[model samples]
Target: MAIWHWIEQTLRSYPELAIFLALAVGYWIGGKKFGSFSLGSVTGTLLAGVIIGQIGIDISPHIKSVFFIMFLFAVGFGVGPQFVRGVANDGLPQAVFAVIVSCLCLFSVYLAAVLSGYGPGLAAGLLAGTQTISASIGLATDAINRLDMSADQIQAQLDAIPVAYAVTYLFGTVGTGWIIAYLGPKILRINLQEECARYEKEMSEGEPDGGMQSAWYQYIVRSFKLTKPDFIAGKTVAQAEAGMTGGERLFLENLRRNGKIIEFDANTVLQVGDVVAVSGRHETLVDWSNRAEEVADQELLQIPIESIDVVVTSKNANGKTLLELSKSPCARGVYVTRIRRGSMGVDIPVQAQTKLHRGDIVSVSGSRKHVESVIEEFGFADRPTSVTDMVFVGSGIVIGGLIGAIVVPVGGIPITLSTSGGALIAGLVFGWLRSFKPKLGSVPSATLWFMNSVGLNVFIAVVGITAGPTFIQGVKEVGIELFFWGLFATSLPMLLAPLIGKYIFRFDPAINLGCCGGARTSTASVAMVAEAAKSNVPMLGYTVPYAISNTFLTLWGMVIVLLLG
Candidate 1:
């Protein structure tokens, strides 16, 4: 009774905190148990805010604004560097495709909204911003103020837009990805795996081998070796060579401390402890070992070891020298034994001062648990999707950004929205236009998920708080009509844009899904398609598109309001 009373009191005192807690709990439970319920952190939080409002709770606008700013800054920092790289590498191809797809999707949504009898400016704003209803409402309200709409009318219209947009995002993410996945293969006539492989090849170009060769070498040592039992023990090099017939070359490698071997020379002497490699037939080596075993012990003391590959994903470790990370709390006991970079399968000895890059793959050998724990601690997980398709996707971003900056005008303005956004659009356009060219690079799915979560949470918090006390009244007035219009605007693009992806550009379903998710700035839906297809490559396939879409959505809202108002 005391705990319950405390809870009730706390809820009353901090209603917004309660709402956030409730949302966190709901998403955690739902994401774990029901796969479809993985609306991600941002989407879940926003939905919670809405639920709180429906139940008559109010949160301060100031708090929401602060959180939104922080979230956006984090997102910008995380993606900014990669965005620049994408543009530099392949600017033209990415630009053309990104612009076309973004324009088509935006146009389709705007046309449907206008035809459905919505206000032109509001429809244009909403569609331009990828159905970001709050941004739309904010822009629309400002436009209304300029046109002399009453304060009451402006507040009323703004209140209901969140609910409408939320519904649109939910349907837009799942529906668009689903429709594209099913219809994309048939319409595009391209195998999903083939497309993914093309992208994977590009990303794989500069990555490290992660110690596959070392393991192979170890395997060879164990599989076809002739072992001798102290054959050179107590024998001088001259004595040991006296009975040998073949002109075989002998080498000593991987010698341990206090270990010694008789050099293959007439004047050299042998010691009891030696590790040597002899080149001869397997049968002769075994016979020699057996013969020598009678005079000594039959044991050959070589410890068996293997190698494994690990790729680094976290930015915290990316630019630091290996020596630096190795000395940190994160690199305890995990020695980087070898590195294989690019197409050469050669194993280079690990250097302490080697700087880690984001996409560098490494081979590490240690106990299984130790390796696993270190990889997890350092955020080194398998990103076959990103690795496989980074090249074309990266090229697309660069090409698209360059072209969009030069040619595509935002309301006839000659300014670039965001370099990363342009790059992303370039990726999407290239993915669509040159379906045969293959994808070039990849980004970690977890990273994308994190970005989406942060962005959405900030967006929702800002929208919810701004709506405030007038929310209920506004919803009662315009909620019904706006709901249908929002649905129409969302669904039309969901249906039509993918059709463009399939028939016109002949892109895969993943591309279509990515386009919708990107346009709306929804990460949950993008993640869902990747998860369902059991391929992270597709997730990356959609990344540039989604990025492009988000860039346009975020910038276009401001641009449309500035121009139209």
Candidate 2:
């Protein structure tokens, strides 16, 4: 009892300890797998904070506001590029569809809240929890505080948010996965694996095994002795290459005739017993392996090869197909292994006909010199770095706050994008700008992850602790009925998603399901659907919808509060 009392006293005296405690415990719990589902870190942190809040630790409200602003800004920045591209390019259809789907989600949750006689705060909470959008909690809290109400009334409403969120969030996370992986295919009446396999075959034509994410290199270099005298002894290197299948994809990197090293030249005549280093796609190399004598020539294999990410910014490369870019002088001897597009950096199908967008990041592998040329030709090289531009971040937030503070009176009620919303907008613009001018606003991916994940979780921890004292009372008032309302809200949009995607949009089965998952902002559901289909084809359609849905659903947090009020 003495030790327990001392611990409680220490937590009360240093309330920030409670926040870190919640984060640590929450992350540990969130990482646990429970049959393909686990309570995510945000939900886990909120629950942990609520339990610790019974200790009555007092924390400054300013802590949550600062972290929430950072979180919102990071969210905006990450999705901005993809969001803009989707709206402007061929992805416009998916972009529009995502917005419509987001509307349906907001409407469904709003209807559920109104029918159940829930107030603004509870409505916002249900929407956030049902949609599994952790960011909405911050926006909702902001909206509730903005209302013309007493502190006591505001605190009471604030308490209701976390309690409702806790009750419904589990089902929201697990249910979405089930719906996408199991129910979606049933609705479409197609075999997921077969469809993915068929799609994979179609996409993989003329392309190497760069179809999935793996550590295995899909391209290789091998040393071959010119032992096939009858077939190639007197033929020139160019003539020999032209006669082989997939010759355009192959490169004779180096050669050693007798005791002398020879540089690569297309007109060089082949000699019997001459050793050559050849590089090409793994499958193509394997097919032709038996045509020559394989040798372990250490000197020939010691070429300085490199793989690197090159951002697409050059206007000459922009809007050009992969086939066209491959023919460029800069692309000589370089192979494009993958293309990462959008905010989430999801890998899209790499095909000859696949066009390069200005912001797309292409991964190319070849001799270091060739790869350097490709980088110079496309855009800046996306080399790994640890530094972040604090100046850009601070300026963006300040500008966003100013933009959000402006108000327009609607029927005597002031309407404004709160500072949080403005920060989000600023993030979008800054992020888009960064894509074009890759040198400025350098927020490293690691820094963004820390700002995004830690910022939101910290704010969530604070919200949970603040609402802790009233949590039990709030749950009692709302009862089990709130759970049912959440179910209806979550299911309605998801249920109609595939039908709308099929009948109206006419998307492929895998893509339709992936878009639905993205529209709900559920990464787990998309992963689940991909696993079930045994292919990553689903992820090709995920990034654009995910970006659009993230922006729309977060804004709905403020919108729901306004409607319910």
Candidate 3:
């Protein structure tokens, strides 16, 4: 009894800690069983924390801060290498496009907030970050501090931003992508899949040496501690090698301005600025500068475009060989260089007349417009325009929304339903009943990773910051009413956003819900859609939405907070 009492006392002292622990435990178990129970992760964690707190357990704010920082650092490190590579490849253009799209979304939200009568700074703060409510909170906090607002006012603003941002973030990730995919061909006047094919062709032709400077050059100069190339400029190969050890491997090659590597005999004398090819470790090659100079100037072909991905379908040019396809009039100037087949994940070169099969994704490269045209001309099946397609899309949204509503309760009163849970239940019922069949497209691994990582980090940071001491204190001071209010604040936006996405944006259902997962930064919804879809494009679509939503959510949060406060 004493030990039980002590344990109980410990729980009472660190309620938040207890809740955090429960959330972690729930996530681990749920994730294992469901292959990432993301909704469970969020709601489970939150619920566990609440339960623990109710049982008198408490946790330190300092600990939460540490966890947040560590999580952010992990995220940064995880994406660093990819980020660098992205910049090196023609990622600059894509990045620019993504940013522009993101900004446009942000501007839209800002306009909404301003028109709704929110102050400029608060609107800016809410609009500044990605879907993460924590980021919006941080921005709002900073803005408040900068404006020298009183602590009370600042805290009030911070308290309300998370709820608003969360709603927008959720909508953007899943729904936005579908909207883009569905309308992009008309609005952006481009087909993404075709664009992907063209990019593949360009990457094939350019083959930019793996973005690495020759390792041979580095090894020779740095490792061998070779003498600097100073005296060998005008000497013959034999003369240049007069004092060097292991000099026989060294050779001189010449080209007449036009690039042609011609081997020079040992007696061939070198001219000033003559290009040379020298082989040996650094020290030995150092004295043979004139020879090295000739080889160093080898002209490299400039590749205009970089990496791209293509999805192969059964309808793709009747399973033609990549070489045959390239030779076709339709494939002119474009080359199918590499093929990444399915989730098996290996890249192989295109062999001539290698017969294509259904579902073999190929990468091709060429000008953007040309690539787009090629895909449009020969790539994928046209979007289904049948009434059946429309019905499927509609039913998906209704069922998904119903599931989400069932899983998580609104107003924290344990209403025995959640928006996410409702969606899942609906999916299971429809799938099991076989009455309402849903055709979910493919969800890619890259898309999954991008949306989950980017969306969640932003969400956590924004939410945590906004729910600072003052906000929490208010909840505590207000008692049960606050809990109900908090629940309402959280669920209302989630429920409404998808409805708007569906009716207004005409987004695909899976894509719509996937954005909800992204906005909340929940991996569960991502995995669910991934499991449901046949292609990864939906995942990519989710990411686009998540990114866009983050910007909007941030702005929306600030606007709501200031206006209400």
Candidate 4:
């Protein structure tokens, strides 16, 4: 006991050490799963920090704010392009369902707040806890400070918020996690593993078969030096490639004869000594090389391979798919190596059916002349430089920060988006713009993940630590009744989620539960949904609604207080 006390004292003396230890231990705890249910890093960190703080650990509040905002920005940036596309596409129904869930959450919070006769502080805290929007604490606090109340009244009300939050927050997390993971599958009467397989098979036609089966797509371009194979001696370039079959198609890039490069033509007859560079996947190229005689020129083998960034600006390519666009006559002799849409790069293994939005910047690779000609058909081609324009990102964040500071009065209730919310909006806009110009804002996936996962956990850990000491006392004041009321707020919205998602939105059970979890901003619930369904199909339904739900649910903290108080 003495040694334990001494260790606690030592950690208290250095706040940074306390925070680091909390993050490490909390993350380890979060990874622990029991039958496909895990607490997740954010929730684990919060619980750990609360326990540590209860025993007298501490960290600076400013550090928590910094971490929280970074998480918001990363989440908004990662989901921005998808959120934008979802609003107008197949995801629209999910988006509308998410709005329905959020409104219901608000209504539930108010119903519980009214029935329990909660003061302004408890009402706001209840909103935050049930919705799992931690930022609401600060925003609600800000709103309270502006209220026309005496010092003592304000102090008493302010103190109640954290107490109410602590009491309800845990169930808000765990209860929803269970409902989505265990109960959803049972209610839907579906077998997760079988359904995922069936869905995958149905969706996989014409898509690139990956792994060992993708050998045909593992293409290489080689310069063949012509020593005459009598078989193809007098055949034209097209005729030479026409005899190939089975694995993949072959295309002649160009012919090099007498120090000049000629574009391949069906009519251009190949001479005995003509050198041709041919491009095709491994299977086709290898098959052709076995019969054709070889000659290698250093310069020709090292053909100037360049990438052109072509923006999709016209209606012809706007809603058409990448596979469809690739087959256009204009796409001859060029390969789409990558498609960059802002911070997001589509994982196009064989998902060639992915629609190209108007602003998409596709990276096409081939010889310089061919790339130019191919790019001209898609849109204007620009050589996207490695340099990321930081000015655009900086300005957007700054403007967003400024915009968040303005408190608007709606029906005589003052409200503001806050800096964090503003940054999220800024990230979304900037991310969307990057999809078009692609010359600006170079945030990558790794960085976004780091900011989101690390940032949210750190903020949560700090909150738990800071809220720990007062936690027991606060719970004592509110009594267990607040918890049951919180359970009502938490359970009702989630219970209604599956019904609304499946029947109204006509989504499968996997997607409905995912939508429900996402609408609540609960990653733990989504993870549970994926685990229960034994497939990532839920995640497809989760993304857009998650983005939209996170933003609105966060703002509703203030809305609940202002409207219902």
Q: How much lDDT does each candidate structure score?
A: 0.46, 0.84, 0.39, 0.70
**How many clashes show up per model?**
39, 0, 78, 2
Can you write out model 3's per-residue Cα lDDT over 350-407, one digit (the tens) per residue? 4443444333455666544335546665544223232333243236445555543443
Off by over 4 Å in 3: 1-9, 25-60, 85-89, 118-147, 165-169, 181-565
Cα lDDT tens digits for candidate 1, 436-493? 1122234444544443354446546545544545555645655566656656655565
1-565: candidate 2 lDDT, tens digit per residue: 9999999999999989999999998888878888767887998899899999998989999999999999899998988877888889888888988998999999999999888999888888898889999899888888899889998889888888898889889888889888888999998999999988787666544543343221113357898887777756688887765637655455677889886778767798989999888776566677667788888899988889898898887878877777677666567677778888766677776665467877788898879866888888789888999988999999999999899989999999889988999999999888888877888878988989898999999999999988888898888877599999999998999989988888998888768898998899888898899889877788877888998999999999999999987
On lDDT, the leading prediction is 2
State residue 282's C-alpha deviation in candidate 1, in Å.
Answer: 12
**Could you tell me which 10 consecutive residues in candidate 1 have the lowest summed lDDT?**
215-224
Better of 2 and 3 by lDDT: 2
lDDT against true structure, model 1: 0.46
Measured on C-alpha atoms, candidate 3 has an lDDT of 0.39
